[model samples]
Target: MNTSIRRALGTTALTTAALLAASGVASAHVSVNAPSAAQGGYTVLEFRVPTESETASTTAVTVELPGLASARTEPIPGWTATTEKDGGDLVTSVTWTANPGAGVPPGEFQRFVVSAGPLPAQDEVEFPATQTYSDGSVVDWNEATPASGEEPEHPSPTLELAAGSDDTVASAVAAPSSSDSDTTARWLGGIGLVLGALGAALGIGATVRSRRS
Candidate 1:
């Protein structure tokens, strides 16, 4: 009922809100943003990477072509590109690296293009990624294949290659669409806001009554 009690409750509420906001930002790091493999063949795949830090820029992107034996990339100007073979045969698996010119500014994104060879006749292929920031921080986008319904603690953008014809594995990674999932989420959030407002009003009223008594 006292000024001190009101102040403490207000501080606790604000602290909770801040914690939620911070958690949201941390969960929203690097994500895949373009054409997914939709009926795969010799097609160009574009990956978009946006740096998270306002003070740091993105300096490099490394794409690990796991299992796909023959994949190549189109040359990017002002950028250094290289490829390395996986263990076993020299042509079995390859990983490519691209360094951006200068650095990708905060809130800005860069695209990486690579040519995929003929996809496997069946099964899915995941193109995992690792992103490097200008401040010497690296984020690996490779999470467990077939995401477990939970956004991973650390998640990477992945392209799912479905099997059909010889060139059936679609080369397109469709961007996440909010239209299907977030509508109910928004309604629930509105309900939560109303509940929160009601709770605050009750607390204020209780404080007033106690002070009068």
Candidate 2:
């Protein structure tokens, strides 16, 4: 192959590999999914936690929601959830602790669901989380992304909301039956593979045409 065509194929392969690695790293972080509702609306939020330690299980997690009007947690069979209220009787945070031998093991993840709202009127919201490991180590995900465009090692889970709507109904807020962000990540990986394959085919065709000329 010509030098230019060879470089193009090599670059494509490297880019695809980088994207796949990033997807795996992202899944290890504690994240929140907002399926519905915006500012001033009621909705259910899903906190997805993955155990990043190779040898330790996740024992507990606490998510904070300051100034929230209300919150109700769903029960998980082996875990106990406690909701904290502010001085005004509004829910401020919720903590979930696993029962004996029930914590999330390595390479596994769990979703904790909570119904909350009326969210404050804002374009974006953050839900900082504190994760505890079986090894007695704690990690806090609370750093805000700065203007430098570099992501922090333990970035907080943030969600962007649409403009406020009075017609928003609480019944419309539906949490996913399962927490599998892998669906979107898989699509991205497939596209990268297709791009790499196309680049190789084009480079080969160009080389063949030139040889015959």
Candidate 3:
């Protein structure tokens, strides 16, 4: 093969391998998401747990919520949920245990949902989790990311709290609105989307050609 063609093929192969590896490891990391959660607000939180063990199933999970005002877990048919509260009766932690033969199997995942909180008034919140496998092993997803922002091998589930909803709405209402400006912005956004799609298509075509060569 010519040098250029060989380089293109090598780049494509490396890119493909990187993507596959990322996707493979991503699910193995337990994570949480609450897109609309705001400071001192109540919102639904979803904690997604994946069974990372090749030979064992996930049997239990425990999440720490030290300052949450309250929490309620959405019931899973084959799972039982419990909470522990501090002296002031605020939920401090929650645990979910899978029933017999109901553990999340290897390569599969389950999302545990919670409707909780007057969330703590903090910029970031971490929900450190402990995972138990049916094979009598436990894993802690409790490491805090350092100031350098490099993710730890088993990073804790975290959420960055936004400003309260009232502040957001007030800010939006305070912004000047103009039909003409809105129209122009939408037109530009549409063009950007079209260009982005075309770029992706060309990228795919180039990769396919490199592979077929």
My TM-score estimates for the predictions, one after another, are 0.54, 0.73, 0.74
| C-alpha lDDT values of all predictions | 0.63, 0.85, 0.87
**Per-candidate clash tally:** 16, 0, 0
Weakest ten-residue segment in model 1 by summed lDDT: 171-180
Of the candidates numbered 1 and 3, which has the greater TM-score value? 3
Expressed as tens digits, the lDDT of each residue in 137-204 for candidate 3 is 99999999999988789999999989777664354334332444677799999999999999999999
Q: Please provide, for model 2 over 1-213, each residue's C-alpha lDDT reduced to its tens digit, 9 standing for 90 to 100.
A: 599999999999999999999998988889999868587787889999999999999999999985566688999989999988765566789999999989999999999999988776778899999999999999999999999988889999887777776554342233221223456678899999999999999999999999999
Error of 2 at 111 (Å): 0.8
lDDT of 1 at 2: 95
Q: Which ranges of candidate 1 are over 4 A from the true structure?
A: 1-29, 32-40, 87-101, 121-123, 145-148, 166-213
Q: Between candidates 1 and 2, which one is better according to lDDT?
A: 2
Q: Regarding lDDT, does 1 or 3 come out ahead?
A: 3
Report each candidate's C-alpha RMSD, comma-separated, in the order given: 29.6, 27.5, 25.6
Top-lDDT candidate index: 3
